[model samples]
Target: MASTLTDSLVGRLVDGRYKVDSRIARGGMATVYLATDRRLDRQVALKVMHAHLADGASGADFVSRFRREARAAARLTHPGLVAVFDQGVDGETSYLTMEYVDGTNLRRRLHEDGPFAVGEALQVVGEVLDALAAAHRQNLVHRDIKPENVLLSTDGRVKVADFGLARAVTEVTSTTTGTILGTVAYLGPELISTGACDTRTDVYAVGIMLFEMLTGRQPFVGETPIQVAFQHVNDDVPVPSTVVPWLPAEIDELVCALAARAPEDRPHDAPAALVHLRRVMALLPPDVLGRRADAPPPVVSFAQGTPDDTDAPSSVGEIDKIDEIRVGGDTDEADGPVRGAGATDHLTQALDTRASGSTIAFTLPDRDRLAPATGTAPAVSTSPTAPVDADRPGRDRRRPRRRTLVSVVSILLILGALGGGAFWWFGYGPGSFTSVPTGLAGSTLEDAEARLDAAALLHESVEAFHDTVPAGEVISTDPGDGERIPKDGTVELTVSSGIEHFVVPGGLVGASVGDARASLSSVGFTAVTESGEWNLDHPEGTVLGLSVVEGESLPHNTPVVLAVSKGPEPVVVPQVQSLTLDEATEQLEPWTLAPVVVEEYSETVPEGKVISQAPEQGSAALRGDEVTLKVSLGMPFVEVPDVLFTPVAEARTILEDAGFKVEVNYFMGFLGNEVRSQSEAPGTEVRKGSTITLDL
Candidate 1:
């Protein structure tokens, strides 16, 4: 995906280390690239903001938004969410490095394959809900939940992405950038009307997505955004049964309630909604509930309905013009946006007529675990949008004695009926009893059942998170060890799953090269190093630093970091005599020696000459100091000097002047001192002031 940015980043080193490989994916706001960590020898996904978005005029706001969103998104940890690895500015370019999810966005899937089948849709929705549940728990509301933000992997895993508009819902407003932004279709009514949003807003958007999945069309559509916004506030969500007649009323109710005009009407929060969905799915007919042993199976069904009233309202006023049904304590309201009678007049004058901003305030019951709940306290206003009812009696005195007596009688009757059924089935009837068992460790559910077959005991799993136990391993049991039960009773075993422990690599902050490598290997960690200075905290050679903190359980063989010590300060290179290349370099390290290998042939010396050194070898140095080493590469040659072919007298003069001692000898025909032969051949490289013997 990062291949898209390769052209612009091919030779450019980002942050002085990341070498862009290729563009991976591109969007209007940013381009993502697969890059090589030059120092680490590993791959990473680099998301760089668009050039225009980082220009001087727009850079600051975009940077701030990117930083805040990145941090908020990072706080979330779910298998169904993309992980942000790092974020910072690389010169003028701002970028975020994130876990590269090998998958296609739902938008791409939709574009290539249109709408999904019921089974696939349910699976995707379940995973998306998982991510949303995590975010909602942290009070982060993802204002945008369109198809583009959903990603589907080949492994059938679905992940939610792009928490750009997500912000923490707190008592005080943290973000003032009132730039209302999100996909027009997915935007909630509260965000559109007052820019006041909470978890319910996300629920509404998820509901729209579910509607599209079931009906293959969005619930609301219009030619303009304002028209769409008006629809969200005034229009009742068309029942799934309306489009698909076979759709169950309960499912329709769930969808309608999630997309309720008021937040309270929705099922508490995302988790509650998800629980309801799971329950409905579990109760689906066995004929429709196909099983998958490989992964979490998908549930499927479709409601059948023909096209009915597709004419959605074009404006909020259309509601009042049609139905005068009381929604929010307002009677005689036109078929438009219903306004609470208590604050209706003032709100209409302020919002519809745009009067000098007047605040709309009310007190909601705060039923969704949203406040410091003290067992349903007195009505108190927190948000301007909440509704208040002053007439409801408080818990202290309003409950009637007659009602309590009736409820007690009713509960007693239900319990008696259940007890009678149990007595007939287990005590006096032909049904048998099973005894609970022990030693569930290292035993499969089937194995446990087989062992307890004679005792007639059955087993059931209670799913829970465990750091000291494996997922499928039982942690503890309902019946104590050795406890006896009915021969037909169920044996709930508490199995011990080995504790999940991950080795945390150390010395990564400022370790030397060798020490870093050794530390990682010793701890069974794979290390990635970035080329930069080892700062004050980390010394060279011990592990300088690591990314993930100690004790985080990553899947086996996860990569980690370790900085090693490079050793103490350097010193000047000492002179060498018979020292080998390896020995020379070792001694030179203290002086930061950088050896340059060379070769030469010498009659009086061995091949691979250490012809001598530069800076004459004794130059002073410091840590990381660079010194040049000149080693003989062997067998030096030379072109004949121009004076070689000159007469004997001239040759003698040239040889002496060139620092070569000349000798004259009478060969068979040549004169004394004539250049008939030479001991040192032409093109031979000799040290200055060294003798070059010659004969004639």
Candidate 2:
């Protein structure tokens, strides 16, 4: 994905420090870009306000608010809050560098996955409320609280963002007469009615967001901005359980209370709302918190308009309608201020009316105002021909007055009793409770139990495995720390057993013996080193095998045997020289050695006699090493040359050259030494240096 920078600012460096990478997203007030902070070598989100929004219509007012976002965010330091790093302007571009959260916004998440589970919705809203509480403590009001401003990281972290509409509680007004800000759907009644915002306003927005998370949609829907704003002013936020029947009654109450039309009826601030939310969450059962297989269908409502919708209505009739319905009024003032046509004209008129000391009369309907007047009597007419009640008497009037007084007294006594009962049921009954002690986690079980006992709270112990908590220490409390619970209510304390079991790490398979032992010890296993069989496949000191297979879970501190490699096994060469070929081959086979036979003629050794081996007897060698064997053949043989029918001298020379003894046989005296017949016949084979007789 690319950063949401405009084409001109895409590759441009802002303030000569942040290198713009790509555009991330664009909003009405600013375009956020993914950028690299060259000076710090970290990724940051650079929010550059729109040129016109920064220095145009609203001018300094808008810029001042833009700057306030940076200041407000910078002052806050919470994990749930995005960090502001730097703020500056390059030419006409006003930008702020902030922590870049690598995750999708809640709006996107809701769009992709629909509504969240009961627990998940509460957790997300709780985290946002926590952030808001922090801002409220600092006297800052996050006027604009919507799903788009809530970010959910891939690592399961939730952060609240976009303080663009944030303003100090001390500020006289959020904007000038012509300007009205905030999303219409999340706007509180006071904000839409009188343009007055405070911490309660943020609480209202969070409540609306919580409803959307649980039910998958906002409560109010209308065709136009005025209609929705009118609903915010007049209608009560519907209970989530109405749409999601399975939703807990507690959640419905929390949402409705936070989003109350009257500010005073709502929680005093975000912290107060958060406390109520935590209490509601703590009281919920596991089944309610768990994911539902049959999730509720998405609630399709009217699409919300842009941020400028706060100024949508431009007529006195619309204002009167909103006001009359809001305050239960009926009379219409003919001299109401006439509004102009513009984006903020309606807002200006509303604020101007208040500024001009002309208050818009808010009169409740007759029925809703008070009980009907009583104790009145019919008067007798004193005109000619006028009818008079002759039966009417002073006694009758006195009797009627007495009866009215008695009825009033009776009604007051009944109302008092009912109000007291209601107060006891809601305030001092089982619902009334105090939060658990803080820092209960990580305390010794005995100490935690003692504290709970002192608080007159009953508790049960439960064992669970924790990665960081030590054995016998409290991992967590069921109601969790700082959650309100009924007096003497049972709380479950989960104590850590110190990693009861773990699977053998697969990484130890080919690791060194030392590394394997270390890994085993790290996982609460005792490693016993043992010498393994000699193997050529693995290097010495390397892990050959384990007694237990990888991924097999075992009890803590179990003794595990580690087999270390000793390399290839050595073999001693046996005596094979001076032995027969068959015997030598058999002798080498026992030692796992291969023997190569070479035959050669020898002067003393008999044919097929014992041979000599290359690797002498008793030589150390590895298994499968080759050994050479030299076998004895007889003396070299050559063919005798034929000297028949030749002269004696020539024959003798030839016989002598052939290295054969010449023997002439004189048959018939004086015959030339012509070898007519030879002891070795032609083409006959004989041993070299063997005596051969020549007959003549």
Best by TM-score: 2
Tell me the TM-score of each prediction against the true structure: 0.46, 0.47
Looking at model 2, residue 200 earns an lDDT score of 86
Q: Which residues of candidate 1, in runs, are more than 4 Å off?
A: 1-28, 33-45, 55-59, 111-114, 171-177, 267-269, 289-696
What are the per-residue Cα lDDT tens digits for candidate 2 across 522-596?
454532446687776787778978888888998644567888887667999998777788888888887778887
lDDT of 1 by residue, 1-696 (tens): 223322667557789877876665554456667677676566666767776866788678877877776788777656677656678888778877665556666645544454555456656777787678767766788777766567676676677777766778872134443344555466666655555678878888888887777666667754333344457766778887676665567658767867876765564456656655676676666443332112112222111111111121111000001100111332335564433342334333323332111111221111111112134568987768553455755544434567789999999999999999898878755564433566665465556657667565666543333343565665555454466566556754544334323466544444456445445434433224444443333444455446567655563234454434444454665786446667777877555456766555543444553656665656665555454544555444333344554567887677676656566655665655546666566766664445554556
lDDT, model 2: 0.69
Error of 1 at 641 (Å): 34
